[model samples]
Each structure stands twice: as structure tokens, then as C-alpha cells.
Target chain A: MSDLPKILHVEDDPDIREIALMALEVVGGLDVVQCASGAEALERAPGIAPDLLLLDVMMPGMSGDETLTALRKVPQFSETPAIFMTAKAQHSEVDRLKELGALDVITKPFDPMTLADQIISIWQER
Target chain B: MSQGSESYLVSLLGPATAGAVVSLAILLMIGLLARSALGHRRQLRKIREQEDDLALQRKAVDMHAMVKITGVDGRILYANDNLIQTIGYSVEELRGRYASDVFLDEDPRIAAEMWETLRRGDAWTGDNKLRRRHGTAIWVKTTAIPKMGRNGTLDKVITVYTDITDAKLRQQEGPLRAMFDRLQDEVYIFSVDDLRLHYLNKRARASLGWERLNYRSHFLSETTSTFDEARFRERVAPLLAGEVEAVIYESSLSGRPVEINLQLDESVVGEPRFVAVVRDISQRKQVEQARAAFVATVTHELRAPMTSIKGAMKLVASGATGPIPDKPAQMIDLALRNVDRLLLLINDLLDLEKLDNAQTEIRRDPVNLAELIDDAIAHNMGYAQEYGVTFTALPAMPSTLQIVGDRDRLMQVLTNLMSNAAKFSEVGGVVEVGLEDRGDEARITVTDHGIGIPEEAQSRLFERFVQAETAEHKKRKGTGLGLSIVKSIVERHGGRVDFFSIPGEGTTFVIDLPKASDEMSRAA
Candidate 1:
């Protein structure tokens, strides 16, 4: 991990993306790149060479799970740690997300002040 | 032909011969009259023998048949020995009695209508219940024929009663009882006075684990633990008093859920009784629970947008983007608070779904009660401040009240209790949390000095979406799922939750969790 970890954040909801951008870039002073959808993230992720992938589980063209599988096919991104953000926070769902190569599953409507710190913690642990 | 010449010759010849001829004529007439008299005597003897034979035939019919003759005015004119014996009455006792008085019907107008029909010179035949001397009713088929007099006026009504009680009962019981026994639902009949089990269909006997000989005299309570004497009386009071036609309730029998439908059967021959039909409803309940979970899942999914909206507002309100004006900041704050309320509703709905579906995972770990309470208080500090209340953990709290349970779920329970305590407390009121170490369990009590729950609402406080309609609660927004969730979580950890509340003084909620054994702690 670098002093300022480069992160790729993929979300379908523009408002949630804006909030996460502010929380990571403005509030927590981390280098963050935002994509409107998983397809856009797949196009930009490898070139950006981000240290972490923050993906929304529900999407329009490519779901977070599909995007993760696609990113794993890329040689450089095969072992990159990915975290899932989902509205469903059931214990079983979280465990399932972890089994799908996600380092952790963060429930939505996350506290804005703690969101960046939570991501950093995950990154540092990874 | 020789009358004139012969007469002249005879007149000269013999006076003695003429006298002899007159005597012969007289003797021949006497012989003819004697033969006619003997023939009349023989015909008279034959007529007398025919009259004796007709009387004997009538006597044989009267002996076998239950014959009664009533006059034109409906008064009994004659009653035969068969009728008197079958009616358990003497002929003298029934002779002067009105025919209607002996034959009774559930409907009095039936007898009246029959008599009217007979008066119209028509025969009446139908089944009737005839009362005996002992006041018991015997069913009979009756035929009454009106006998017209020689002057062509209504004369007498001759009625014959045939015993049909046994046959009638068989006709009623054969197909009817068979149909009742073939039903999938369990059927029961309980005596009205003692509430003793009078009859149970085959399904009822098998479902209730009863045998014919052993359950004959058993009371209803013996078969079901759900209905003791008092509860049975309470539930059946309306049915017995005829206040309601039927009553329905749900109860568990042998740990299986059943719906019981009880109806008053006052039309039974003797005493009024209760007829209950019980059907197992466990599958129905499971389906209902599943549907509720589905609705909750959809609702939770719907909250995703609200979550994003609240998150955006929160970020903007924190001055992360830029400094905001005071009015917009206040607006954002208000929106944020409402968002929190919506989130609470969504969370409560999800928790209920999880609880009902048994999808909540319990990962047992050693949890310390005192530390959990302290963390809960700290977590709810902001809420306490908003409610203008303070939370205090008693200094005498046990240091190590350990239990085996999921820490996060237990923390959720404690947080709910503290949040409720803060919400219900008066301004500047102090909420106290205390712990007691019993031998086998640890008890935690949360006491709040505030307007307590109303007496009427206390019983249903833990039911889903049931909020007390008090003035204090009216101003506060609650999903009413906090306490129910607390109860579910505590119970899943092998604990019990209860509360004591005074209407105007204060309330105390107690939760008891079983202590973890050394071996269990080591195993965990």
C-alpha cells in the first residue's frame, strides 16, 4: 500500500458516487477514481492500476460480481483486493460476498465520516 | 173340468166324501207352511255366524294396531289396548284427553294443521314425536283417516301410530356420523354442564392420543394443554350464553398449532353442548411468515435510494464539500433526522424477517454484560442528548457477567433498550442500567424515570407495530419494533425479557441470560 492508496470506486447511483468521492478525496485526502458503472470501471481500472476496488453489487450492464470476475482475468489485477458495497447486509449474503473474492462487504447508507476510514482500514489490513 | 156335472152327482152320492176332501186340503197347506218355517230358521243361523266372523276380524286389527279414534272436536273417543300399552298409558287415562295432547311435535302448528286436514275429510300421514307417560318422546309414523257419518258430516278421526324411533335414529346417524368421521378436521362434543368429553370422532381420538375406554369420562382439559378449565370457560362463555353463534381461536396442541372452531349445539335431544372442529394450521402460519419476510426484503431493497440520499446530505452537512449557509444546514439536519427514522424502520423490518425465517446467524462468544452495557450507553450518547436525558451505569455492576452469545446481536438488544429508555425519559431524567449475578444466569435491568407505559398498552407492547398512543409517544417517531427485536434476540440466546411499568411513575425492563459454563467458554 502507498502513503495515499489509489482506489477505484464503481457505483451505479450517481449521488452515492458523489458522496464517496467527497469522503475519500476531500475528507480523507486519498487518491480516488470514480466510475458510473462496472463497464466503465473495467475499461479504466487496469490503466489506472488502483490498489483497491470498491464495487457496488447491483448494477445495470455488468454486476459487481461479473466485473470482479472480469478484472480477475486481467493478469495485473488478478490478486487486487476488492470490497463490495451492497444494500443486503444479511450474514449469509456477506459471507457469500466474501466467498466471491471480496475482502469485505460494506452495507449501504454507510456513515460518511467513517466511510473513508473503514476503506483505509481494509486497505491497510490487506 | 167336471165341476158342475160331477158336483150334482157327488152331492147325491156322498156327504161323508165331501167332508174328507176338505180335511185333506187343510193337511196339505199345513205341510207347505212347516217347510217354509224350517228354511227361515236355517237362513237366520247362517246370518248370525257371519256377524261373529266380522267381529273377530275387527278385534284382531284393534289388538295389533295402535288405534285411536278422536271425535269431530279433536277429543279422544276411543283408544285401543295397543295404543295404551305403547304410549305407557292406560286407556282410561287417554280416553278423554285431546289427541293433540298425546302426540307432540317440535312445532306445535304441525299437530294443529294435521287436525285441520282431517276435518276437511282428508287423511293425514307423517312422522311425529309422541310423548309417553314418562315424558320421553318416541318417534312414530302416524296415519289419521276421517270417518264420515251416514248423514255425510265429519264424524271421527281414526289414527294409527307405528313405532319408528329406532329406525329414525339409524336413518339420522348412519350417513351423518359417517360424514362427520370422514372429515379431516378433528371433531369433539363436550357436555355443557361438566365440559366432559362426550364424543370424539376418529380424527379427534387419533390426534388427541385418546382411546375410547380411557377418554370416555375425561374432561376437555385432559386432551389439550392449551385449554385448562378457566381458559376453556372464558373462551366458551359466549358460545354457552348464546351471545355468539360460533367462536374461533388459535391454540397449540402438543406443540402443533391448530385453529379451533366451536359452535353451540343446543338442538341436541337433551342438553346444550359444544361442538368443536379443530384444524392444524402450522403450514398456513409458515406461509404467512414467509410472505412477511418477502415483503420485508422488498422494503429493505427499496431503502437503498434513501440510504444514498441520507449519505449525501450527511456529507454535505459535515462541511466536507464546502461551508454551508445556516438555513440550508438546518434543513439538511432535519432531513438527516427523518432519514434516520426511515432507516430505523427499514432495519426493524429486516430484523423481523430474519427472526421469522430463522435466518439470523448466532455466533456464540463469551460476552461481558458490564462492558456491553457501557458500550451501549456510549453508543446511544447522541440519542440521549437529543432526548435531553442521561444514562448511568450503576457502579455496583458485576465486573464479569459472562454469557455465551453473539456479541453484536446482544449489543443490538442493549442499544435498543437504552435508546427506548432515553426516548421515553423526561427532560433531564436519568436512565439507570444495573446488573445482577444470579447463580445460573445474569440479569440486566434498565430503569427509566419517565412517563411509563399506559396500563392498557402494556400487554401488547412487544407486538409488531404496536405503539402506545400516549402524548409522549405521539411526538416521537418509532417503528415499534425495538422491543420485539430485543425479545427475539434475547430469546435466541437462551434468555428471557420482561418489564414492569407503572402508569405515571417509571418502568423497568429486565433481561436474564444464562451464564456460560467453563467448558462452554473454553470450547468457544
Candidate 2:
């Protein structure tokens, strides 16, 4: 909410998580705190206050929307903006995630180099 | 009474015998008068008894239910008291009003057909829907008898009706049970209180092995091969509680797959029942599971790996890993392009599968065809430019064309057609998308001045997995499912698609759709 610094990211798959970290940290040089599941995200939310929330939808236990819902209950992250990364690539799915109040939806198999620019562009447009 | 005739008779007769002859004549006249009086009395008595008999018959008929007399023209001439009380109309209000207008439906054909039967000297008996005072419709069992006049012409028709609305609402009755017994699918009638079987159709009897078991004593929980009493009760609890009319589920019966629909027969009082209809669904389940598995594999299994593979390939191809040699880089480009093609194939498979099994609902919203055509041409212009072809939308159509269809699906249809045309068109040639205002139907045309379809393959072009064997076969890239998807979407909208082609000359693909207003009118 304040600046383009810290991001709280949650995804179930380790490979996608590694790629996302490479895309965001190594390439874009943005600070981020990552978690494996929604429960872990909840556990880390009170300690690390991130500017934005990046999440992967269609997880095993809780979906990205549910993670956002759980995090919004925290006082520090109540109004934090969220973006979702999804492998189920359908335009309707994007619309649905947007309806759940995501700032933007990035479809799967995305180009890693431009992933940072897409998020930054979205932030600027908003 | 003639005086002259009497005097002539007296003169003719001898004066001495005149007194005796006159006395005999007076006695004969008195006897004739008494006999005439007796005859009159007997005839009057007979007439009075016949009138009494008719009055009794009329009273008995009136007490039965509503009764009305109509003229040959079907105008109410008289109505009984029961009729007046039941339909909320007085004798004066009903008299001379066409029976069709007062009691029958608004359709004149029903009245005409009923009268046609009556005039042919046959009684009309059927269930009739009668409108009450506040426009509520009630069902009635009606019997109309035709009365004839002395001149042998149809004089009037007397109709008798009894209220059958309650019975009609309780649709499960003796007559319907008889029909249920003859059904091809298995049927079971069971008591709701005890869950004991009451009746079973022949199919149910044959398949249930009725050699030694007493069907009447059998319980639902004990009948099916994989009977789960707790699960079945949980499923049917809503119906028993009146929350729903029926509950349906698929389970194995006699170790075979079946779909059972159970409905509570609460309409009958004192003895509540359940009607369960079972259908064998082994074949359907097989087909459904196969389709579902394929889609699941494509979406869940292949998609995750494809994401990693394609992304890694793209990062490598773009030299994000490091600066690679020219030869290997070109091959990486080829691999990336083919990966993209595989992704496209996955998407096409998804779309076609959804359309095939009716996973997507084709909406009937009114859409402007002309605007959609223009949008499709604009959207595909970049793709067309890749083929050295220019996509063009014709000038304003003569009239605005509107149709009932799913706008996105229709766009998919139009875009597919335009791209197909653009792909095969000659280099630097123009491909046009146009709309035509057919009166009852809206027409969309996609025309290309490229190598047209061959006469032989043209007939099967729209079939799935079928493609034209063009000279540049390797050049045209597709999943061979685009035209079939187009056909599927168009058909779902109650429309048709066809093409006119001359090989090496040109091809024009046309899609005809029912206009929105026309579809609405047809539904009405």
C-alpha cells in the first residue's frame, strides 16, 4: 500500500514459486516474502507487513481468494492490494478472480522477464 | 243442429212412429257424449303423468353438478343453480354469452372443435379447463349431450360438468399407475411410512428377481445391490420434508449402473407413497467418464508441465539464460513456436470439448450481427496481415440485422470463419466479412479470393477432424477443429452454415441465423 517494496507471495508448487522469485527478486530487484500455503501466509502476515499480496489460485487446501480473505482480517493488511497468478488460463477465470477483488490476474506460463513490468504497470495505472 | 233437416226427417217418418224414433235418437246421442268425455279424461291423465316423470329427471340431473344448455351456436340458453354457484355467474349474466367465452379457453378452435363433435350427434366428453371469477383456471370433467328438435335439426346441447381440479392436481391416480406399469424403465411404488414396496413395473419385476421374494414386503434399503440406507435417506430427506418434489442420484442396482428418481406422492391422503423410476445408465456413464477424464488430463495434468516447459523454453529462446549461437537459437525459435502451437491445440481441444458435451450454455441474448461482424474483422486483421491478406468489412448493411445468440460464441464463429478465409487467400488479396438482412433470418458472409475448397472435401469440411487437402497443405496451420466448432456454435443458435467454392478461384462461407424477433415470435 505504501511503496513498491515488500510483497507477500503464496503458491503451492515449489517450481512456480522459484520462477516467481527469480522473476520478481533477481530480475525486477523487488523485496518479497514468500509462503507455501494460505496457512503459512496467515502465520507470516503479523510479522512481515508487505506492500502487496501476490498469490497463486487453485491451491490444495485454500484458494488464492481464500488466502486474501484470511489476510484481510489482519489490521496491517486489511486494505492491501492483491494480484493472483493462475495456471487455469481462461478469460472467464480472470474475470472471476477480479470479481473477488484482485488488483490483476496473471495467467500461467507467463514470460518471466516481462512479469515484473506487468505488475509495475498495473500499479502505475491504478 | 240443422232445423230443416230435422223437419224433413219428421215428415218422412210416419207421424205415429215419430215419437219412438225421436226417443231412440236422443238415447244414442247421450251415449256418444259420455264416451267422448271418458276419452278426454284418460288423455289428460296420461299427459299429467308424463310431465311429472320429466320434472323428476330434470331435478336429478340438476343436483349432480353444473349444467348448462347451449344453442346450436354455442350460446348459453339456460344454466342450473349448481353451475351458477360454482363459476360465480347468475343465470342472466350467463345467458346468451358464448360458452367458450365464459367457461372455455380463449382459443376459438377448442370451442369450434367441441361444437363440431356435438353437431355430428355424438356426445362430447373430456377434461375442460374453466376460468373462475378472478381468472383462475379450474379443471372439470365435462359431458355434453346434443338435443334435437322435431324438425330433425340440432336444437340445443346440454352440458354437465363436475369439478376435477383437485384430482387433476393429484396427478398420480389409478389411470396413471396403469400407465406407469407399462413403462420401459423400471418403476417402484413404495409406502413412505414403512419404505415398503407397493407396486413394481414389469421391468422392475423382471430385473429384481421375483422368483421367491415377496415384493410387497421388500424395503427400498434391502432391494438395491449397493443400498446405502443412510445415504439414500440423506438424499431423499428434502423430498420427504416437502422441501423438494423429487431427488435423483446415480448408483449401482443389481451390480449395474443406474439413475434413480424418487418422488413423494403426497397428493394422496391417508396412504402416502413414493414413486421411484430407475433407468440403466451404464453406457451413458462410460461415455461421460471418458470425456471427463480427457478434459481433466488436458487441464490438470498437461497444463502444469506445459507452463514450466513453455516458460523455460521461452526464457532460453529469448537468450535470457545466455547469448547462444545462431543455429541453435533458430532451432529454439522453432521449438518455442511449436510449443505455442501445442498450447493453441490444448485451447482448441478445451473449447471443442466444452461445446461437444454442452458444458457451456448457449445464451439467447439479442445481438446485433453487423457490429459483431465488424468487430471480428477488426480483431483478426493482424492475423490476416501476417498472411499478406487484408481483412475488410463491407459498408453499412441495408438494414440492421439482429439475432438471438451468445455474442461471444458468435464472435468466435465469425472470427474463425474470417481467419480461415484470410489463411487461404492469395498474397495481398482482400478477405471480406459482410452481413445480409434476410427477412426471417440474418446472414453473415466471409468471402476469400484465395485457393478455394475442392469439390470433394467441401461436403465434409465442417465435420470434426476433417480438413481440405490443399496443395499448400503444410502451410495452413490449424487443429482441424475450427470449422467444426463454428458449425457447432451456429447450430446451437438454431442456425446453419455452408459455403460456395470454386477451386483456385474463390470461396464464400455463409451463416444463416434466425432474427431475434423471429425467434421470439416462434417461441410465443
Q: Who wins the DockQ comparison? A: 2
Model 2: CA > 4 A from native: A1-6, A25-32, A89-92, B1-43, B54-181, B184-297, B363-366, B398-400, B517-524
Q: Identify the leading candidate in terms of lDDT.
A: 1
lDDT of each: 0.83, 0.80
Score chain A of each prediction against the true chain A by TM-score and list the results.
0.95, 0.92
Off by over 4 Å in 1: A36-40, A60-62, A99-101, B1-300, B319-324, B395-400, B517-524
lDDT of 1 by residue, A1-126 (tens): 576579999988887888888888888888988898878988998788998899988788998989999999999899999999987776667888899899999988788788889988987887
Q: What TM-score, to 2 decimals, does candidate 1 have?
A: 0.53
lDDT by residue for model 2 over B1-524, one digit each (tens)?
Answer: 36776677779986657667777888999999999999999999999999999999889878877899899887899999988877788888899998777766535676677778887878888878776665456678899999988877788999999888657754746677678777889998887667888777778888878746678778877676667767877888889788778898777887888888999875543246789999998888788778856774567566667777776766677666778899998998898888888887787778788677643557667787778877787788788878899888888774457887788899899878888888888889999888888787888889999888888888889887788776574479688889988998899887899999999898999999877785463443
> Ten-residue segment with the worst summed lDDT in candidate 2 chain A?
A86-95
Q: Model 1 Cα displacement at B15 (Å)?
A: 99
Chain B superposition TM-score per model:
0.44, 0.54
Query: Residue B61 lDDT in model 2?
Result: 79
